[model samples]
Target: MQNILFRLGFLACFCSSAFSGVTYPPITIDLQNKPPGHQITEFRTLTILIDTRIDVININAGVGFFLIQVHSYMGNITLSDDSDAQISGTNIGLIWKGNSENVAHFYLFRDHLALLDNITMLIAVSTYSKYDPVPGGCNLSFETEIAPYQKISESDDFITVISQPPSQFGNFCNRSNIVTRMYYLYLSEHDNSTEQYFANIQKMISVDDIVKYGTLVLEGLTANRFKQMYSRYAGTGRVFAAVSTRLGRSAAYVPAVSYGCDVAAWDADCSGPGKDIFSFISGLAFALLWLFLWRKFGIPVVAVQLAFLLNGLLVASILFYSQLGDIYIFANDATFWTCFVCLLIVTQKPFGCLTSLFYIIALSLVGSYAVIFAVNYYVGGNLPYILLNTYRRITVANFGSAVIAPPYQTMDICQTGLWVLIFCIGVYVQTRSSMGRPPFPPRRADRARARVDENTPLIEPNQEMPPAYFEAVYS
Candidate 1:
């Protein structure tokens, strides 16, 4: 009887070892290059491999889980952080199944992080067993250490790295606040790369800090300039208030409530070029030049149009080249070239009603946009959506390296007043100047009359003989 019992015990041990090997393969998570703590800033794919026996679906708030609220903004569904709130992605279905494997993968649908700014996602790993959550048959048995394995292919859409929650976070299946690790990722707007090092999460910003520095507003602060100054503070987990207003009006600042990158990281001052002073001067110069000399500088006006269109094409080409391997829908080079050829044909012809009409419309728009762009630096303003998008894309494409500006949002009475004033003035001046002008350049008779006025002799040197002279000789 004793010998038989010993053989049964050995057989049981051998079976247990074989089952463990089959269930949990080697999965090592190299946390060396990643940001300090649990943050993952610059990864395309973050896969969390949890044991199949862990019960993640029925997590309870009493077990350190926080309530999440959903809201709608402008007809789009959104998540809100209410008082005593926390957020998660998988709960709301943001993380979909990338493969049949039991791994958690988060795929960010929005390309622009600003759209999802100020949002934090919590990932909870419960210790409850899937088979029995009633405090019985709890299988807290898994490998403690995992070895490194092969990396996912770069050619694949998602570069995958398997990871598991740190072992230090002890069992929280039945208790509250056993251990919870907060992580953050500060990503660049353009390439989703790490902007800077992650800082300790400052859950609260002092009232004094908000008043003394956060609410301080700068004069002539442009969206671009504001971002340029504040982006350095990104990932530092600082809080501040941002104010956009007209004519330095005292807009109430909303205090920062959460910790995220660039929530409102505005500086009191910037050393770069002053926004209003330079843009106002340059924009005013262009508007005034166009307004006063629209008729005199017709060819130059056409040239400017050419330059503008060509610049747009250049930007498009650069964007296409930069995103060569990525998939995106943008205007092709052939289409842009075709449009360029068409514009050249239209603008390069001799002055006519069509050309004159184009001159008035194009110059008026240019003047209007320039004035608005400059004035918005001092007083926040709104521009037409299409024009604004064009301006933003061009500006960012050119100067994204130096600074990244947020999209414009403010719209007030001052912006409308200035835009109307400048646009009307441009149209009025161009119209009054162009009145009574011939649709086409002067005909031969008109040229002859002008030449006679200039005291040219009737029988001139080597000129084509007039019909009158030929008729006399033939008769």
Candidate 2:
């Protein structure tokens, strides 16, 4: 115990040096007119000294999770703190938030604006346009709060996002007497209202942390930056939050009830004492990403990375194997979150030499999906319907079921499916550009040179080549 305390002291000292204080710089987001919406209102401060990068400990009051959103940057990030984690070797479902083998916790995800670097990635997703275009440049909207989901977390029902501290020393969910500092997210009008319902569980966070030291990335991303993030963690989903806005006047923060993974609704009317509608779409999005990675990265690396990316889950599976049969969908998001981060940092350049086919297959799916999803967001209520509607989930959940009420007056599932098929063509086109290309090959000469560095036997051309050549000629 003394040694453990000593280690804790050492860690705290190290963190104090590394991320102790905060002086986060404000990033700028350039939107065409009307940057501030009605949703950017009210303020409830959180802690500043916690970290939500790798380990996700628990989902309790004010300690396990927190949401950091910035409209100016087009980012919707969720930081989880689980001291305990676990993973498995399965391909269909791997890492999860808790100990359940079948479930995974949903970590936070963000989608940055497309124009940040002005360089379009050659991804092939079917949900978005093949050549989906946005503004020429991108900027982080520091003043805006685009996600409404971040708001509904202050309080509510079956889906409780723990706000106060936990009770037990190790029990992060029970303590409520303490207060700290970190990042805080406000709400906005032109944002994904559904996200407001998704839980932004945290322990203790404050605005001072970001306000004090978070550096503003002003130069914009270069190809090198993308390469670095990609090579390390190349993945299938959009990884940045493009904007944020908080509106206090309209929506009141109310906790909603939940039955299993499904959020409790008043009467399936899609309204009443519930949260934002953005969550369903966001959930669908990350799911699409998971599918894309499987198709692209293949199974080997995916398994290895998932094991590390979701260590908490691996721990849980080992300890909770007996209770595996019963777990919530919320417990399954951990693997999804791992896949989420993997999507951000994994890139194509690394595998370009190892295998081009894999890269082509992976990027083709992701690129197509991204293009189509973006197109759906832009269409507003004009084009909608499932099995084809680009933003079908959003429209269906928000308005009604597509089976009953289609978005447009005259578009059946078949007609919408045609457009979806058309969008898929664009995905194929972009994928053709991104796929089926040959990866880099290791040359014999290069290998020989590298071997020389390792004190390996040299196969000199002058000595070995002549004999081999003579043997070949004679033979």
Candidate 3:
């Protein structure tokens, strides 16, 4: 009994730690303050952004492995100083953990401590575990490494564009949806520091041409308290955009910079999200359609789903041929396409219903594609991950001109087409079965054994019937 009690107590503690284990290090977080009049403590930090190839290197470890797991949903990160943290010792190495909502961030790996403004929140830990790189104490020790970021040629005085006009890349830039994508490509490819923060630009190359250009794209999100920022800065006349590289450079690609004013920047091409994606309201309609004219409408309803398949296909094709945004529109459109697509898919029925139940899986794709899918090693969650969503660009079919552009997103387009075809065919079979089969059939339980002699013909109901016809006359 005592042992069991001890075990239960230990288990409870373990569970608690798992739920709120190591103190997660946040970017630009405010350290705890002392009593009311106490002077605020300050820390020194420098940042240099650099990207090194992910060739496996042996890391020395003294504290079992101090992994730093920093998480953020808003893709915005700010660094006040020079570069990423440097890890001088050969023994100590960095490991990172990405949140279900965000993989684009890292406190685990070495990156520049670039929080233009630090957040004011301090989280302390209750226990000493191997996972904390950041033991918060009076004397905190930090590691450092020195590596140079990918550099652009001095002559390449390029511009950063957040969004172009309708002339955007389909997968990366969409005037209709995305304000901007975090990176031109995946997180790994961002080693080259060619990208700038809050940049939108004309496509010197297609969205998929990151490899060919060998450039890094820094056009990420602004998780900054935009509402507060505008109220304090833009609202109070802090012309950050005009002053900083965030906007207003008329060279290579950066055009007229704009803020996220819903009214001013209304996406004219904003055809609303797909109808099936908005299928929740359709539930009542579908029920009524079923109750009143189930047969008539069922087939018709399926036919109407053509809009879904087509829209999904349009989004998918845009994603598939993402680098070829010139064919689709003016600015890069990938990010907006993903954002809008996810919003619609997650909102609608069937798909929306699945979103609630699917848990981590739901996070794997759909809504947070750019953030969550940035590191997708191609396994793509429960379903294949997509440059274009699987429902549409279903496969990783190779596309693009051989010399200039890389293949759009990766997947089996042929397989996806085959599956969609099979699904439709299966639906057809089921519909036919529903229409042909009877809802219920009769059961034969009420038959009594009646025997007539072979020699005697059956009598009419009106004729008198007797149990013993031969003896009837005498009886």
Candidate 4:
């Protein structure tokens, strides 16, 4: 009877050991501020003190190797005998206690688990802030080498892990949703190719899986925060398209969202209207200059014609290139064409130097006032002012919607005033020079010389007999 009791007691003890599971304490290590090239030798090890059997030991170093073990909870089956085993590349070794009843300790030695491809290892040990709370009772480190692990979804009590990779690990412990933010960690692995990285992203976006994941957030990785972020992810048009479609208009990390429009569109809107005004002002100024040159220096009609023809060719070339290449060159062509047309009209009619000068001054004054009126009209919320209307029609007829009215802020009123002053001064200088010059040359001496008649016969030096005949010839 005593022997029977001893056997029953031993069986009860064995059952208790089998049912109990090992619980590890919460650990957080912060390696974010660690200096580059610094090596870490010691880690806060997880030790098993009880005489409990370690059914399975799982270690995921992220990229080098993947080991999976499956065992039925109802049966005592061994999935893998990792005891006394060492993993290559990582140089990871497991130490078991004497008699092989329990695991003694687990540790990372030298640079064994220091780095991995596509996996960024960060230690946030015992660090707390208003934003991030401590993850409780979890000793294992997290890795995102697999595409599915790239996103973490949040709920009230737990967070779901999803990725493009086949393996599916259910919910992770998040007792109170302590980790409210998502961090995109980038690991620099020389052997890792960007092709696979982009492929994973493409797969995730195709199924619309990223949208189901909670809000995606990224911390600044460099000094140029926006530029870096843009270059890293948003630079890809496919990624941008996915982000825009999934998040609607509320998504973060999109460079276009920060501004009202994309870079090219914003530039066009800001410079469009201003370009129109500038072209008009340029035309007016050129007309004034043409008048001054003709009235003051007397530029010949042929010279004026040649200048216009050359200018027209140049403007045409600019337009052609703008159509074939960049749209910005349209501004230059518009300005040139406007000026060319103004000059052409003035030169078309035959006018004397004085008449042309006065006409140019009058035209410039009227053009300046017209500009002020057009600016005021546009500024006052009027659609299609005279100048803008004419410019828009021309641009649309030629370049489609490649050019439009620029924003009001781009107009330079002071510049217009300066050009007008220059025109007025030019006119004044020409007037003064013209007034200073004599209308015709003096002819007093020429009139006296004309009185001697060449037709009269010359008298011989020896003969002086024909005085009355010489007087008659002189008269």
Which lDDT tens digits does candidate 2 get at residues 1-475?
5334434543564466468465322122111221111111112211232111222222222221122221211122222112221111100001111133311122111222321322111100001111111110111221111111111111121111211111212222221232221122222211222233121211001122223322122221121111111000001001111111112111111111112121223223222222346966886897789767665544545643443333323223222222221122212335424543454345433443544444444444344444444454533222211223222222322111111111122212334465557556655675576444323323345445445465555665555344554444333
What tens-digit string does per-residue lDDT give for candidate 4 at 1-475? Answer: 5334433543454466457753433232223433211112222222222111223222211211122111111111111122323221111111111232321222221221221212221111111111221111121332312111122232211122222212112223333322222222221111123343333232322113344422243332222211122111111111221121111211111011111112234334322223457877887998798667655545345444544444333333323322222233323555546654655455444434555454445444444445455654344221223244334435443332221222122233453564467657656765666563332212345335444577744664765464575444333
- Give the 10-residue window scoring lowest on summed lDDT in candidate 2: 228-237
Which candidate's lDDT is highest? 1
Error of 4 at 105 (Å): 39
lDDT-superior candidate, 1 or 4: 1
- Model 4 local distance difference test score: 0.30
In order of listing, the candidates' clash counts read: 0, 135, 56, 13
For model 1, give the 10-residue run with minimal summed lDDT. Answer: 147-156
Residues 219-309, model 1: lDDT tens digits: 2212222221222211222223332122222111111212222223323221111244686589689868865554544445455565455
Put down candidate 3 lDDT per residue, 1-475, tens digits, no spaces: 5334433543454455458653232333221322111111112122222111122112222222112211111122211111244232111222321223212222222322433433221111111122222111111123222111111111111112221121111112222331322122121111111122111221211222222332332221223211111100000000011111112211111112112121122232111111233555675677676556434333433433433444344444444333433232212246535654674454333533322222222222232333333223232221122332323222222111111112222333433444455545544554455453332211222111233468656766666654574353323
Q: Which numbered prediction scores highest in TM-score against the true structure? A: 1
Location of the lowest summed lDDT over 10 successive residues in candidate 3: 230-239
TM-score of 3: 0.23
TM-scores, one per candidate? 0.31, 0.19, 0.23, 0.21
List lDDT for all candidates, in order.
0.30, 0.26, 0.25, 0.30
- Per-model root-mean-square deviation over C-alphas: 20.6, 27.0, 24.0, 24.6
What is residue 196's positional error in candidate 4, in angstroms? 39
